[model samples]
Target: MPRPPTMEDVARAAGVSRSTVSRVFQNGGERVSADATVRIHEAAKRLGYVHNLVASGLALRRGRQLGLLIRDATNPAYGHLHAEMNRAVQGVDRQLISVTASRHDYGTAEVEGLNRLIGQRVAGVFVGTGVTAAEDLVETVTATPMMIVGRPNDHPQIESVSYDERTHGRLMADAIAAAGHRRIAVLTAPLLYSRVFDLRMRSLAERCGELGLTTIPVDLLPVEHGVARALDVAREEALSCIVCPVDFVALDLLRAAVARGVRIPEDVSTVGFDGLGDGLDLLGLATVRLPVAEVAREAVTRMEALLVATQEDAEGPPPPGGDQGGVDATARARHLVIPGRFLPGRTLSSAPEHLRT
Candidate 1:
């Protein structure tokens, strides 16, 4: 077999020293001249040289890897979040170690996953899963820096970049009202199941109350079975709409309606959060297109800033007024809520005259 190309080979081809090539790749190209950086990259591409990030971290014996704990990898929302976070981490030239957990359990698997990442000596962890409670996650990671991502979190001690579910819920409710849905059925789940979903339902119901609209609460336990019951309620009570906490649930309801020969938007309107699934327009499902990519990008950016601040604090105070990389780990926690826009599909429209009271 032929010997593989190495950074030394790349340096010789780019007319730079080996150390310069090392600094350019490992330090995110900071401090290196743009021309030199470009030459180094082009030369490496020509030679088919790939950086061995894992080996570099091993040689340094320091945490050069970031960890991500996400829930239900199969779920489209989390799946998209995982892809976006990977892109952001790669942009900074760091390796990402990801862990997945099912939502059915009581977060034991998630806690163990966190420990595994900590055991790998990761510098920081991004908790993007809605499966674990914020308090439990906070308690588990005492040594490693942890940040909440893509989930609702308000712990005074934890910082998070999450979707603005409250605003999303309100926006959805306004849309329903505008469509002449005076009475609706809201599918809900226990808070322990998913705080994100709970917040969505609560905000939608609250906003509906403010609008003087009637809301029928339907418990969605054991999702498949609950969705069937919710459909029944929508039909029996002559509800004008059924609001789902997530797109998957809304899809389930739409499928069930089809099985029962029920017409969507004509018999009863339907709406959901998280516009991630394909064929949404074909299915004519109304939903909110969540800012998954935006949240993922911001979360990784925050994680990078946090890592820099931690390093500075350990190396001694920065010279007075020195930049802390736009993040202060010692400061009180900060929460950022990014909003999503609504998709007015064929599923939600004016209720039938006989059903609209």
Candidate 2:
């Protein structure tokens, strides 16, 4: 039997993509360039291909969908939070769909995700930090309920559930300073800036300054090369301690220091934020533990409230398997703040008798 042509055939012939072909066919939606549209048709003719969305049409409908937007889905901190929410939504028999994007894709993905969610008529959306610009989401969630999880915004259209990041920074700085460290390095996550990042840095620096300790910021090299960079920073700066914004970065620095013949706490000490399980227990890392489970529970309760309120106007939810967004009228502008707990570990200690700098 002869094979029937598909969208992939047309896309390849037109020098475009399967999605571009889809955009052309779904003229009710995305606008493909006129040139590309013309080429799509020409290729369809040459290849004897007919675009059929029949399979997509026959997919099962998920009537009660919730949307979640987060970055670095592989990160354990966000992973635990996402898992709790997923379980809760399922317990109530609703499906949660999520969209995970990189920090670079934050702007376009949030807006696009929201548009897709609204079109799918999801009951509500739960947005994680770094997903998109907060104000954009404030305006986007008018028709559906939206709970901004792990992110904060001033706009009255949305509610935010957040950790008290200010306190988290102060705790780390206080612990390091109290240990009598004279000079320290803040190993930050690659090079991304956000409100949370800025807040943490400012608080820690301010506290360290108060203690007459010198606090310096250094861009953490990616994991593969991070240890070497960390060792260089430590020896060059004569640093008494290395403070990491996240535990994973802290671990990398520790491994690097040990390889360079530096003794943990005996010569130099280390501290990090986010005391995620297993890793922290194994490393005995002195860190600040975020209340992820609390944050997740709050987000679920708030978003579910909004979803129930929008049931009349909302349509069947987005089909599950991925992330989504929705509009909610019942959601009110509110901010929730939670504090972090500090964990002491063997890695922390007093400053070396004679600091280098």
Candidate 3:
């Protein structure tokens, strides 16, 4: 077997200094004279010289790779966002390295993994979800560019891009109220898994106050196979409408309601958030379609800006609290509330005549 060609062999064959070869590969051939670049290419082709980016990045003290840290890829919400984020990263000409931390048991190991990406010198990071305790991660990646998605409250240093859960919640409340739903029950997961749901809760409460609607608070429902429990609660409370945090839950409710001979839109309307793909239509569910694509695009944009800032500050003073700036103020002062449109499917309608009267 023949030994692989090295940079020195290419340099010698091209009749150019090793430094010139390095510069040509490192900073694109356009940086070098066109004649010299042609010579290098010819030599490289003849000698089978492939650029070792790992070694090259080590020599330059920088890696051009970006990290995408997500909670669970299986979650439809994150899955959609991840695809969009992948496309956005490619569109911006950056490579992405993905890591998933278990939603069930996210611990310090996951944090260490994120830090490991930095040790490998990733250019930037996009945190999707499931990272509990971000204070350390935020500090470690202070000099690295990063963006956090779907979290409302901003970290001191990490930039966050998310849909306004509060606005979405308020909208749901208003829609139900407009349809004359007096007794509304909200079914969702525990607070830990329901940050957005919490916001929605607050907004719903506020909106209900304005509309003189009464909201019933029920125990948090398990996301996986909680439809039965939700259905039981709906029946017990005689809810006029049930606002679910996820489409799956709404779908389950529809099934449960059908089994119990409950007429949708006529007996009890249902609304769900996070408009996923098809099949929801077949169930005739009403939902607020989240702007997943747009949210992912904006998150990537924020990540790019943070990366640029990190690179620019590489030689400058220590990053302020090692946190990404701009995101905190913007997130707090004015949440990027992307409005969700109500998909008034066959599931929601005005309350029954008896209830209205």
- Highest lDDT: which candidate? 1
Candidate 3 lDDT tens digits, 240-336 = 7777777767777777778878777777788887777567778777778777778877777766665444344443544356423222322322234
Model 3 off-target regions past 4 Å?
1-61, 106-113, 130-143, 223-226, 316-337
Model 3 TM-score relative to the real fold = 0.72
lDDT of 2 by residue, 279-327 (tens): 5876788998888878878777766665444443233444354222233
State candidate 2's TM-score.
Answer: 0.70
Which stretches of candidate 1 lie above 4 Å from their native place?
1-62, 317-330
Q: Score every model by TM-score.
A: 0.79, 0.70, 0.72
Each model's total of backbone clashes: 0, 9, 2
How accurate locally is residue 332 in candidate 2, as Cα lDDT from 0 to 100? Answer: 49
**Ranking under lDDT, best-scoring first?**
1, 2, 3
lDDT for each residue of candidate 1 in 3-29, tens digit (9 for 90 to 100): 878789989999999998887655545
Following a full C-alpha superposition, what root-mean-square deviation does model 2 have from the true structure? 11.0
